[model samples]
Target: MEKNDKFPTRKDMTYWIIILILFMVGSFTVYYGSNKDMVSHIGFGGTIVSILLAVIAIIYSFYQSSTYESTTYKLDTSAQKIEEATKQLSDVSEIKTVLESFKGEVKEINESIIDLKGISNNIGNGVNSMKESFENTKTTFFESFNPISPKHVEVDEIDFSTNYFIKMLDNGGNFPLFTLALANQAHINKISKVNLRQYNKIYMKFLMGGKQADLGKDIHEAFRNIQFGMLSAYKSSRFVDIDFVEDDFIQINDINENLSQAIVHKVESLNDEQDGDKPLYDFLLTMKNKLSWDEE
Candidate 1:
């Protein structure tokens, strides 16, 4: 049934048939002779040569059959190896494709990291700029009002210590002048126990549009006089009534309200060409919270 099988089988049959014919011819020549002695003498050499030839032919057929089988086996093995190698190459190609995809994803991740770093740097720069701006505004606010000399007072001066109120006075607008006068009157009464009722009187006077010609100078004098009086009282410990001073006009809400109004007015007066007012506003709020008005 196999293609190669047919060829080898046919060759083997041909070799066997030739050997059988030689053996039959040699046997017949010996058996059917006219004289037994003559047949033996004539056929002996020929029979021996034919028998040897038949043996050589049979051996050659077996050797050729073995060679064909070995060649066929080697061809089959080589074909199987080629098939396995092809399969391995295909698998390697698939692995290469997967590796390429992985590389692309890694590239994208690296780009994202770069973008995030850029964003972080921008945020840091913005925060630094804001901090610098705040510091500058703070310096300006404090420098605007210089402190009064210690030697310039009639009565002992109360170093309210914080210069914010004085600075507000220096900013100079009608509201600041009125607020300073109010604070001064309160400070004088606290220390002197003068019972002047100046706060009630002045509040009414201002409400009724008191004279404005010399009002500014009057408020400044009153502020200085009150500072000296409070300082004198503090040194003697004669008017050390913390409750009395704290309960008067220097309450937290009252100071905050005055400062808020002053700041609003200042910001509103600025021209369109002016810078932002947020820093100044924040400075005022910080100052308001820090106002202790206590002796320290």
Candidate 2:
């Protein structure tokens, strides 16, 4: 058994014992007084006094005993209830403290989650902005120069560096100008065969295709006009073509030496120019005109 249940309170037991002792003492006193023979001369008065005293003693003893027992029992029960209530109150206090701490932690975590969501949204928007910039730059470059190979096919990725150089020149990105110049030194090479007749012919055909909104003339006359334009455009230049059955180091060197210098000079001039602040949609519209379809 628990220690609390085993030990009864001493006050309750002592109160009952005192009431019992009082009853015994009162009973003995009344009996002895009533039986005394010497009180015969005062006969009736003595008997009446004795009987009254005895009755009084009995009533007082019974009342005291009942009161002590009832009071003690009630006090003991009340004290036990009070102790239980105190313990329950303590438990409730501890639970409330823990709950408050947990609530604070939860609030902090919720704030962090909100912050992370905001950061994620910002990053997503940044990536989209970069993608748009790249696309716009790409469209601008393709519009200015359409690169077709000698066979009239698009150049492969192996020539991407050369293509990048040409596009940057058209759009005024000046950084690569010096490098292109160095690559074009003629003393470094000679005896090279220069060949670009087919590409020139195609460019001429495209320019005088009679698709101009305002220009109106005979179709064959347009072709004649294009021939004259080409002569004037390249009047100071001369070109000769020679095919090599095998790899020729001298020819390759000559080709690079002749073409790289002039292109680099022209590219550097364009690079010094500034980029226009035109809206992207407007730029897109202009670039799209070079293609066959509409801007949509």
Can you give the TM-score per candidate against the true fold?
0.31, 0.30
Per-residue C-alpha lDDT of model 1 across residues 1-296, encoded as one tens digit per residue: 64574555877989999999999998887677667777686688788889999999999989999999999999999999999999999999998999999899899989989987876575455435434533443343333332453322223245332343333434443333333333433343343332223343343233333421222443434433443444333334432232234312332112233333443445433322464445334433332232323222
Against the unseen true structure, what C-alpha lDDT does each candidate score? 0.47, 0.43
Off by over 4 Å in 1: 1-54, 65-73, 76-80, 110-114, 117-121, 124-296
lDDT of residue 282 for candidate 2: 33
How many clashes does each candidate structure show, in the order listed?
2, 0
What is the lDDT, from 0 to 100, of the residue 5 in candidate 1?
44
Specify the highest-lDDT model's number: 1
Q: Which 10-residue span in candidate 2 carries the lowest summed lDDT?
A: 173-182
What CA root-mean-square deviation does each model show from the true structure? 19.8, 23.0
